[model samples]
Structure formats: C-alpha cells, structure tokens
Target: MGSVLAFFVLATVFFYNAGNWLVVSHLPQRADAIVVLMGGVPERIPEAVDLYKSGFAPRLIFPDDYEENPPEVLPDGSLLHNDAAKAMHLSSHFNIPDSVIVIVKGPALNTQVEAEIMAIYLADHPETDTIILVSSSYHMRRALIIFRNEFASKGLEITIISVPSRYTAFDPEKWWQTAGDRKTVFLEYIKIAYNLLWDRWF
Candidate 1:
C-alpha cells in the first residue's frame, strides 16, 4: 500500500509539467499578417487584435468556422454570437478598421483543417512571407508544429511566429486542481498522441 502511494505521488509530480509541455510562447514581430486559430475566442482573438493594433501585422486572418452552424439572426435582424462576429465586434469596439480583417472562406473544424486552409490561402498570396500564429496558451505548441508541417508539405517557406494567448486562466503548475483544467490537459495529451499516430500511420 505504501509503495503504491509513493508511486502515485511520484507520477503526479512529474505529470504536473505536462501543462507547460503543451505550451509554446514567442514574442511577436512585424509580420505580413496575423492568424488567430479558431476557437478559444475569448483568449485568442483579443491577443491577435492587440498584436494588429500594435502594428505587428497589417491584416488579421481567421478561418471561416461558421459553415456548419451559420450565424443566427434575431428578430431585430442582428447576428447572434459566433467567433467571427465576436471578433468583428471586438475589432470595432477597439477602433480597428474592418478592411484589415480577412476571413479565409473554408471549413476549419479542427486545428489540422485550419492549418490546411491557411496554407491554401497563403499559397495564392506569395507576398505574405511572415505571419504571427496565435492560439490558446495550452494549444500553441501543437498548432505551431502543425502549421509548420503543413506549410512545409506545400513547399511554402513562410516564417511562423507563435504567440500564446495571455488571457487564459490555466496555470501550468496547478492544472490538475480544477476540473476544467484537468479535462483540457487530458484531452490535449490525447489529441497530441492521436496526431502523432495519425501522422505516422498515414
């Protein structure tokens, strides 16, 4: 019993670092455009907006994730809440011009799909050589890798700068203390493993 408890404690200590392992952070630089990965809007969109406002990039790119669930319209004819809508609202609220925002018209149901869509978009616009990539703090590493691989596969030599969203409440040191964090970290590891095997097998 004592040995089992000791092993459990040891494992917990080592596993505590998984949250940090899943994260990647990089300082933003002047780029051709900023691509904010869909999902985690509350955290990611703001970061990308700030980067755009800071003159780090001239345009903001977002995948059209509204294909499956098109934006709803109220009786007042106003659009309901969605990532693209939310981003537009935030951009206007912050005094950013709508012209600088580019919505890549493609289905981006997952990170891999999003990467593929971005690659296709960039291929047509060879003038864009650098981009700032933004995602949730815990998702940045995987996203960066996927984007890099996708670009490489397409023979695109774009420079990618990874910047994790700063507004997330996830604390890497105590991720296991909360139910939300636990689920997020667990699913992330599972996704990492699945992507690894998927890449290897196919």
Candidate 2:
C-alpha cells in the first residue's frame, strides 16, 4: 500500500511537468523567432501558425531535411507531406506572408540532425534571439533535451513551447487507449522518468 501510494504521488508529479511541457506558451516576454520541429502532422503546423498570429515570434522557420508524406504521391519528384503542405497552406491562410516564413530544407533525418542543421543556420544569422520550440506533447520532453544540447553552445536564449494536441493518428478524443497515444505515453513515461531519476541527456 505504501509503495502503491508512493507510485501515484510520483506519477502525479511526472504528469504535471509533462502537461506543462506539452502545451506551447508565450516566451520570456522578448522573443525574436519561432522554430518548429518537422514531423509535420495535424498538430505542429497549426500551432506554429497560431504562435505567429499571437505575435510570439517575428518569423517562423520550418527547418527540415525531408518533406513529410506528400498529399499526392510523387511521380519523379520529391514532394511535401500534408503536414509540410499545411504549413504552406496555413501561412497563406493566416497571411504570414513569405518574408516572415523561412522554410529550410536540408538533410534533417531526425531530431539531432535537424537541431544541428538549425543551429548552423542560426549561427550565420545570429540576430534572432529568444526562440520558441514547437512540438507535440509526447515529443516535447525528449525533443527539448536534443534542442538544448544542440543549441546550448550556440548562445541563443530560448524558451520551449510544447504544443500538446491529438494529431494525425486519429480520434483525438480517445487518446488514453489508442495505440498511438499509448505508445507516446509509454515513451514519455520512460523519457521523463529516466531523465528525472538519472539526469540523462548530455
């Protein structure tokens, strides 16, 4: 009974932090740019647009190596996924315009590589300070670790804005039992628990 009670107490703390990390929020009152992680889905693109509209960042940079799954299959050319395309679509819808939106396509195969590449871009253009990292709820914890590591030495003052939402996998409402939700939660549990206990991430 004691062990079970302890477990629940720990679980409550973990979920509270996770909930905070999942939702994207305003930065430290002075922000210059917003960068979105590219696993484009129903969640990220819209979140970025919403941030832009909210005046969180002056510019929105979508840095990615590959276009996600394109809406229509490509014949001989690489194309953008619905998520990526949605960024474009939302930009137009929100009247963000082309100037404030920077879409950098390199070889960002994963989060680490993407961070490295984004760091390089920001290095050259160092004027933009104070950033908001937009990502899914489950991804925020792990993603922030990578983002911090990659950007640590770069000298950019940044704040993370985790956008928690039920995206692309479907049935946003019934996440507790869904396979995707379960998988995400399991991963998140491992990530947060491990990090809290072990102080992982170098």
Candidate 3:
C-alpha cells in the first residue's frame, strides 16, 4: 500500500509540473538579433518586440512562410500579403522600425523548419553571432533544442538565448484546470516526443 501511494504521489507531482518542465527561459542579454518563432504570434511577437525595444538585440528576424500565408487580393484591389507578416505588422504597430526588421524567407511549416531557415539566413549575414530566441512559454524547450540542433548541423557556432513569451495564456501551476491550457500542454508533449524520435533514430 505504501509503495502504491508513493507512486501515485510521484506521478501527481510530475503531471502537475509538466507545463513548467516544458518551459525554458533565460535572462535577456545584448545579442546580435532576436528571432521569434512562428505561431504564437499574439504572445511571441509582443515578447520579441519588448526585447528589441529594450535593446537586447539590434534587429529582429522573422521567418516568412509564403505557403502558410500566401498573397491574397483584398477588396481594396491591393495585394495583402499576410498583413506584412502578422508578426512584422504587430511589431511595427508596437513601434519597432522597419530598418531593424529582417525577413528570412522560406517554407516555415514547423519549428524545425524555422530554425533551419534562420540558420541559412545567418550563414549569409555572418555578423549575427548571438541570438535571442522567443516562443510560447510551453513551446520554448522544444524550440530551443530544435534550434540548437539545427545550428549545430549547419556548423554554426551561434549563441542562442531562449526567452519564453511573458504574454502566454498558459499557467504552469494550474494548466490542467483550463481546457485551453490542457490542450496546449498535451499538444506540446506530443510534439516534443515526435521531435525526439525524429532527431534520435530517424
């Protein structure tokens, strides 16, 4: 009975802290650039903007996925291309100037793709040695790992500092209490597992 009770307690603790375990945050520092991972724009973009405005980095790099957001003809007869990339537009609205906004164009379907494309972009712009990586709080761990691996594979020795978005709706302590939080945590775990499998054996 004692063994079973102990197992239950351990399992409960792990489950409760799952959301927190998935987050990887680091203190912001002066870096060459800030790269905000795609998706989680509502939260991630603002966080990246804060970092940029705070002078953590001289510029912000946004991955552009034309496939994910193709050009659409608006009712005004002007071509609207993803509202200048939603993240970029919001950053501008937040007062991040156009001079410091760099767009890395690619088919960024996932976090891995984003990292790969950014690595490619960095290869051309060799000045950007250090980077501040931003993403959703729950998505930071996987994003950081994927980015590190991507840069390593490309033989780039970039210093990456991961910063989880402060604007996330996820509450690590009570993630399971809300439907949205539960779904976010569940999907994040699945993605992490898949990333592990893909990176390790495949």
Candidate 4:
C-alpha cells in the first residue's frame, strides 16, 4: 500500500509540472489585434506591449473591467478606474498611441464577459478575424477555453500567449513544494472542469 501511494504521488507531481508546458499554445507570427485580458498583475501589459511593438498586431484592445462605484480619486489624483489606469500606463509609459490602443467599452468583469464584449466588437469591425490573447502563464488554459467557447460560432480565431507573473507564488516547476502553489493548481483544475461541464450542459 505504501509503495502504491508513493508511486501515485510521484506520478501526480510529474504530471503537474509537465502539464504547465502543455497549457501554453503556440504563438502566431501576426494577428489582427492583441487583446490583453485584464486581472493579472501588471505583467500582462508589458507582454502585450512587446507583442504590439513586435508588429504582431496593429491594435491593442483592453476590456474595461467592471468596478462597482470606484473611488473618485486615486493616489495619483487620477480618476481612472483600474482598467483605464492600465490603459493610460500603456500609452504613457510604453509610448503606444491612443489611436491604436482601444479600451473596449462594456461591463466585462470576468473572462466570459470579456470574451463576449470582444466578440461584439469583432462582429462590428468585421476586419479583425484573428486575435492574439495575452494573459498569465497559469491562466492561459482556462482563458483559452472560455474565449474559444464564447467565439466558437463567431468565425474569430484566437491565439493565446502567456506572460510570467510576479504576483503569483505558484511555481510551475515546483508546484508540489508549497501548499499555496498546490492550492492554486488545484483550484485551476476545478475551474477548468467547471467551465467544460457548464459549457457542455448549460
């Protein structure tokens, strides 16, 4: 029994590390737009900017995440909400022109809503057929699932690119070493399962 349990534990750890690599999809050379799904630490913006500067896309789309009654004044005296603040940072710090950076207007508080809003925008534009999605490394799997499911019938193609985040303590290589990383990975698996089942049945 002891040997059997040890073998199972070793197999689980091996799969966890190997699965992280499998979650990342191959990045395309170019796309119509680079859509940065907001929520992660500031790491996503820099990654998106790099992709944009590399000529991967002509435009950067940021979905305005919903915030209930945001504070009127930020620490810097800017009234911009979290999403808008990040957009401004992209423009000011990264030197991206406001014209090319589009802040998608709508109540997109989560990945599902963000995908829906992006679909509507693409439907109206018609010119943007492909998009490169920027998100955190651990989040890429679920994000791809949700976005692809949402845009399945819309004729829009999405490519996912993951950026390493400093905020998360989850180590992909040593995920089983810490309780936090284990919990994080466990929750992600649960969420992925939930999304799959929910989309299929409901």
Q: How many residue pairs clash in each candidate?
A: 0, 3, 0, 0
RMSD of each predicted structure: 3.1, 4.7, 2.3, 3.3
User: Which regions in candidate 2 have their CA more than 4 angstroms from the true location?
Assistant: 1-30, 67-86, 153-175, 189-202
Flag regions of model 3 displaced more than 4 Å: 1-6, 68-80
Those runs of model 4 whose alpha carbons end farther than 4 Å from true positions after fitting are 1-15, 18-22, 72-76, 155-170
Residue 125 lDDT (model 3): 83
TM-score of each: 0.88, 0.69, 0.90, 0.82
Ranking of models by lDDT: 3, 1, 4, 2
- Candidate number that wins on lDDT, 2 or 3: 3
For candidate 3, give the lDDT of residue 2: 100
Which one is best on TM-score?
3
Ranking by TM-score: 3, 1, 4, 2
Q: Name the lDDT of candidate 4.
A: 0.74
lDDT digits (tens) for residues 1-202 of candidate 3: 9999999999999998998998898989999999888777889999998888788988888887654345655566645465237777678779889899888887687788888899999999898899999988999999988999889989999999989999998898889999999998999889988998999987
Pick out the ten consecutive residues of candidate 3 with the lowest summed lDDT: 75-84
Higher-lDDT candidate among 1 and 2? 1
By TM-score, the better pick of 3 and 4 is 3
The lDDT of model 1 is 0.85
TM-score, model 2 to reference = 0.69
Task: List model 2 lDDT by residue over 65-98, tens digit each.
Answer: 5654435455656454644455665567667788
lDDT of each: 0.85, 0.64, 0.86, 0.74
lDDT (Cα, tens digit) per residue for candidate 4, span 70-90: 644757786755765565575
